[model samples]
Target: MNYQTFQPHPDLEALIKCYWTLEVPAEPAATKQRILPDGCIEMIFILGDDVKRYTSGEEYILQPRAMLLGQISEPFFVEPTGVVSSFAIRFYPYSFANFTTTPVKDLANRETPIRLLFEEKLAADLEHAIVNAADTQERIRIMDDFFLQRLKEEIVIDSILKSTIDTLLSAGGSATTSSLLKGEVSKRRQLERKFSKQVGLSPKQLGRIIRLQTALKILLNQPDESLTSIAYESQYYDQSHFIKDFREFTGVNPKEFYGNDELALSSLIYT
Candidate 1:
């Protein structure tokens, strides 16, 4: 397996978090992997083998050759049909809406093929260009060009929303909306509505996901840290609260998650 993340072009940094890619050799049998919420939206282009995304405990649907995997509120499972290679663009919570008129909330928890969101001809052409790219750098260039062409001048993002999300991210989900709004109850309510339309999750939900992400990073990168220390560092009320939230998003406790095969792909990508 090979995984790596590429920094977005300078001009696209405000909207995109990063572009990432993965490749895995074909295996005789399939393996299931758990995917946890990471408080971001992604565009995934499957370039090698097909993959199945579980729709129910025993049911699944094939992911598109090019698709947008929306903001997820829960953990889910997916298994590769065989070998896999893909390029993905991870966008900030508030950034995807600037590219599409589709209500961001409407796309939560599922895959929406690019055809459903873009002009058919353009979407098809874009997929072809990316999948046929000669290398990772070429793939990144293909995506950068596609996004530059799709950039909109009329789509406006509110400064308050970015700052609020930034505050939550920097605080690792410890900041409250009231604190973010300085007790301005009206704007606080307004922020929730705007967040739903643009971010696909409420501020409280996004904060929790961000907190969980912080903990997961610590767990992956710092082997010396114990769960108690991670909990405190992540600003959970206590160890149990931290474990509870982690289990809710990852479907496994901290100790069980470490060195877990079900989490192999995610661990590789994140680490």
Candidate 2:
């Protein structure tokens, strides 16, 4: 398996976290890999063979070429179809809304073809450009140009939603929905409606996930730190609360997560 990440342009830095490419040579035997959530959404372009996503015991389709994977709230399994190579962009929670008109809330826990949200021709062209780029530099250039063009063509960011996101991000996921909306539940609901339309997850859900991500980063980087200390630092109520949230997102406790080598790559990608 080979994986690498590329930095995004300054204009897209706030919206996009990083662009990445993954390549795995065909194995003598078939294998399945489990993918866990890290609180973000991704736009993926499959350059080689297809991959199957399994939810429970059933298989979910990840069509060849390109797709948009919504905010995954839980873990899933991926079975590679022979040799696999792919390019993907990881977007901040609210960033993807800047480019598409599809109700992001409707895309959760599933992968949909890019054409469902973007024009079929444009999506195909973008996938081809990303996969067939001459080099890493060219791939980065293509991504930046595509996003910039999309931004210019249709940038309809709602101010209240943007402000709410700003608060959540600024607080490092510590801000509550009430705090964000200045204690107005009605306004909070209104914001959530708009957020659901574009960003998918509600403010509260996003905050919780963001908080989980913060704790994960700390645990991965400072393995020596105690769960109690991490809980306090991450602003959870206590160790029990921290453990509960961690288990909710990762299906494992903090201690086990720290010791899992297979999850190391996932932790790095997410953080």
- Model 1 CA lDDT for position 8: 83
TM-score of 1: 0.96
Q: What is the C-alpha lDDT of each candidate?
A: 0.90, 0.80
lDDT of 1 by residue, 98-153 (tens): 88889999999999999899889989998988978899999899888778767744
Clashes of each: 0, 0
Q: Output the number of the TM-score-best candidate.
A: 1
Off by over 4 Å in 2: 25-32, 58-64
The per-residue C-alpha lDDT of model 1 at residue 117 equals 91
- List all candidate RMSDs to the true structure: 1.2, 2.4
TM-score of predicted structure 2:
0.88
